[model samples]
Target: MARKIGLYGILAYVVYGLFFYWYLFYFADSSLQFEYEGSKADPATFLNGRELMLTEEYSKIRNLLFFLSTPFEWLFYLFILLLGFGNAFKKWAENSSKFKFVRTAIYLFWLSLFAFIATTPLNYISYSLSKSYNISTQSFSSWMKDELIDFWINFGMMIIIVAVLYWLINKSRKRWWLYAWLLSVPFTLFMMFLQPVVIDPLYNDFYPLKNKELETKILNLADKAGIPAEHVFEVNMAEKTNALNAYVNGIGSNSRIVLWDTTLNRLSDDQILFIMAHEMAHYVEKHIYFGIAGYLLLSLVGLYLTAKLMEYVIGKWGNALRIPAVNDIRSLPLFLMILSMLLFISSPLSNFVSRYQESRADHYAIEMTQNTEAAIGTFQELTRAGLSQVNPPLLVKIFRYGHPTMLERISMLEDYEINNKAKTNE
Candidate 1:
């Protein structure tokens, strides 16, 4: 039965992949083409013929990869469990170590290593696609170096989390999920605090913004926005990708605005200021805190659901899965599978909340900067640089987009401009 189930899982993933590939490459281009009826924002007005074609092709491939990778991950975990690899690793760890912590480290090292190997093909596909499209500026060796760094950092973090989780489970089987959720709140915050200072620098160089004149202008805007930012930092992302991005990261003392070198090089001073204004809006409106609160609430519910599902699945299929109990270390893959499925199912809800916050930030940016042309120009340049779909399909918007589409943003800015002009005439 276990072998049959595993075979079915593989077949399902293969079938889905073929269908998704066909839909994206063969059928989706014509079907997903969005036409603008609004007077303000039109694709043709911004993107040239070649640009339009490139964006469509690039967006399709990216969407295809994004949708397929999650299911592929699910299949990978199912394969590991059904093949008895999970139990085999657990046994190996036991024989290798007398201490529980050491045993856990050994078990997780193997699991993380295999998971990394399984996912590398998809990761490489993404990298190769980016290179072909002129998006990535990274060499193969540099990319692999970053990939190794990510693997080790993630493995270390996983060890810490899994150790705490299993310890909680042993202490109180019935209430471990609740306790885990409680502990995760602080741990999540600590990671966020550390991310800006510690983890980020490992991947790219970060220092204060070089253009001191532009920095002062940004600081003036920050002062007006009531953000207590003392300095702006710039990251050297040109070495990796041609993408332009900026964000406000961390909490409290770590909180500051960061820009990509690509952004400073590619955009005008006014446009960069508008981008800065948008990022500052995230801080001023407390979106970071709100996001954290929303995450904690959802995780509380998700953990509760995951605990119930894990108990039921292990109770029924313990022998088939080779997981003796919910609390067994070998059951980690099952736990992760259930949690991944839940997270995938809930993506639309989380994405909706994110879009709302992003739209609010757009409104704040326009109100603060009062430069509709700069805002519109910035959005156009961003789309061109990233080759982003200005108007994606409805399903993609719901499942993938966290911000308003390029069309929506440009239209909003145009509307804002018209309203302000009418008020001035009055």
Candidate 2:
């Protein structure tokens, strides 16, 4: 019964992909319109309040990928397949007359290496495409350099993480998933510590926010929020990619607000402060801890059930294909691709977790700063720079959006301000 259900799970993935592709092409709009001063009755119509538009159509399409949804869906799907199949294939290779564990290991190593290389080109392509349109400062070479840096850094990290995960699973015969997640807390902590100060610097230059007055205001806001210190920083994210993003990353000394230079260049000081305050809400509320905790719990369940069936699936089908080792380097792409598919299917749940936290932070930021106009302007600037989809489909937003759209956020702010005025008038 478990095997049958597992097979169905895999099959459901394919069917879902076909459905989403159809939906994306047929129904998803290329442009989004937002009202800054008013709202449309339709939930599908996102309102801000201004008469101005926040995004161009192409940007809408692009943002529909990346931050909202992956543009390279196939690539993501194939990655998962390789990871799932490789380990199970190992046991089969063990039993095979011609296959050996060394061969399997070699296969996996190459598969991972090649898979990383192939997907890497798209990293450059995204930047190049933007530059060609005269929207980006990045040259192909510059983007490639950043891509190579990220590739090496993430590739090395992957090997270590994979080794740790496999070890926990391999050593513990039963309930390995539980053990793996239990240990992942420290691993997550290490990542939080290292990401801003270490991993990020390789790809983008991190510097102190240049505007002293703005920085001081942010620091005061942080102090008001009960954070110990303030180290406002800016990064040259536009030098690599044009995506406008801001995040509250790190813990303690490593803690800081990382704003993309594009974000700084586009938003006003007040708007920037609002954005910073919103990011602080995440740290103040400890959203990252909750996020990691949730992921670990999910990973425990997903990896355990999936890993168990992997052996049977590979033995029955993978070996029959005459592929001696499913874990071969060539197969690495496929494995990762498959895992991404499962994750994609699981996206709605993941996105819900992210959206809830982001929304909470948005509300917190509004409360902390009490600057609805700044918040509205910040949302508008981000929408214009990032080319956000104003009102995405319910399912898509629930599944894809890591943060609420400019239209959604600004509308919430607009309503609050309007209500506050009405109360005062009363």
Candidate 3:
């Protein structure tokens, strides 16, 4: 009976995850659905559905997510570290392995601590994990610089957010969530504006575009598309590593064509032209607007759920804190844990949406470039530069990868080209 109950509990978790999303995807009216064409008549139109949804949804998600996510995310991190330690110990004991449980525990303890203090994870994770590969550009000092900057910024931001939210919730207990939500909107907007503007700069150097010839070529493309040429710029990506990349970020004044230094260094002039054309495709599609909209929709729903759920959860932790306020710092761990669970449950769905968008972008990139050979070459170089696993396990890739593996993308591109050629020959 006990074993049966355990199995049912496991089954229930899986069912809850699936049912929650089925309700969202099936019942939800996110007509924000999109289709990508190789050569769109108006590139900006690709993101029409998404753009329509952005402002409406953005308001709901940003506030709700920040509040819900703030309390639970950190706790999830602790859970993972503990689980990893426990697993490592179990393995060590089974074989009496070279590294005993005690030693293993010590190693994980120190590495996680150093990783925490040095902040060399996330964006530079490739550097830490790619030690065996030829592609990583992270040195200890460089890693430390990334780690420290990230730690202070996040740590300081959390301290302020928690303090302020606690203060507000104390004063407005009956309907404090509404005011908190409103206050959070400006904070979210500030993050959207300042994150890429201020926070991004602290990590990677940004500069105005140079190389008049290359700039001119990009400018002409923008002009042809009716996108202002002055909006495009270059950032110094070469200082850290030789990995080529580019993307379009923001809308209006924030919107700009950002080219990584490595991209300029690696690709031929024509290749760069093709790459920029692909990026222009995204700008033309208005993807950012819709993307933000999707985020808002997800948040509003999540926030409603969180406020009710958090009150119940926080009430328990509140009794323990002797502080009736919902923003007790001691309960931070519990909230973070809940958020982590929420994210874990949502991970598969998030990846599904991301994968769909990425596929559309890839299709647009190829169509705008109209250069299959160049596209292939660019992807190949990127795969090598980033040391991408071309054939990652399907389950692994599905959960973790936002973009299709290089092999899958290359295969699709090749098929498209072959089909087009057959028609041409006919």
Candidate 4:
């Protein structure tokens, strides 16, 4: 039964991969063009011949990479379990330590290391693709350094989570999921709070916005929007990627406006202001808090479902999988597999919520700046710089896009311009 389940999972992934490949390379290219009536927002108008080619090629590969990543991860975990590496790691940890925490750290270190090594090929492929397309600026060594940082950070977090999760399971086997979800709320908030100050600076240098004149203008805009922002920050993203971005990060005191140095160097002052306004709108509308609430809600349900699924799987095939029980350390791979599957399934709904929030932010930026041309230009520049598809396929938009497409954004700006001009004429 376990072998059949694994076979079924592999079959499902292969079928999906084939469909995704067809959609991206063939059908999407031929049929997914976006048209904007009387506006120069179409891909052909903004992206040059070379850029159009790059965008098509880059978008296809990137999407394919994304499609493969999760399943690749699941396969790694599955292989580890099937090969009895998970049981071996658990036994090694048990022999190494009498302490539960120490044993967990030991077992999870091996697990994390294996997962990291397994995933490196995909990660390197992504990096190489970006480098080939003139997107990534980081050297291989520097990129590896960032990857190492990410690995360690993830491993550390996994240690904490696995430790607590197992403890809850041991304490209250049936209600462990409930307790885990309850505990996760605080942990999530704590991580969010620390992310800006503690974690971010580890990768890139961050300093107050150097352009004092523009800084003052941004502050004035924030003041007008009632955001109470004291300073705008500039991160040294030019060392990493050529992509342009501005964002609102953190909640409350940690909250601040952050602009990628690439954005500052590449865009005009008005364009930067439009980007800042868009970011500020996220704060003004309290999107971050709402996002947190939504995440916790989903996680609660997901954890509950995961618990039920874990029970069913282990009860049925515990011996075959070498997982004695749900709480057993050997079951970590199965736990992760179930969670990953749930996450993949839930991605479309999450992306829909994200797109709605992003659309609201776009509308707010337009209304606040009242500079439709600047907003439109900003979107165009972003597409060109990132080689983004102006209009992606329906599946791509549903599963991958967390923000409106470049075409949608530019067309909305054009409509706003028309509406405002009509009101003035009246």
Where does the lowest 10-residue lDDT sum fall in candidate 3? 36-45
List the pairs of residues colliding in candidate 1: none
- Candidate 3 structure lDDT: 0.58
**Cα error of candidate 4 at position 415, Å:** 0.6
**Cα RMSDs of all predictions?**
1.7, 6.0, 13.8, 1.4
What tens-digit string does per-residue lDDT give for candidate 2 at 161-243? Answer: 55555556457645655776677778878888998888878777899989888888988988999877657788877665555
Rank by TM-score (best first): 4, 1, 2, 3
- lDDT of model number 2: 0.64
Candidate 4 residue-wise lDDT, 215-258, digit = tens: 99999999999988999999999988999898888876897789
Candidates 1 and 3 compared by lDDT, better number: 1
Tell me each candidate's TM-score.
0.97, 0.77, 0.67, 0.97
Clashes (N, CA, C under 3 Å) per candidate: 0, 33, 16, 0
Query: Residue-wise lDDT of candidate 3 within 52-157, one digit each (tens)?
Result: 2432243223222323332233433344333343344334444554533343333334334443643333434435444334334657687678767766776567
Instruction: Return the lDDT, model 2, position 72.
Output: 54
Q: Each candidate's lDDT (Cα)?
A: 0.90, 0.64, 0.58, 0.89
lDDT sort, best first: 1, 4, 2, 3
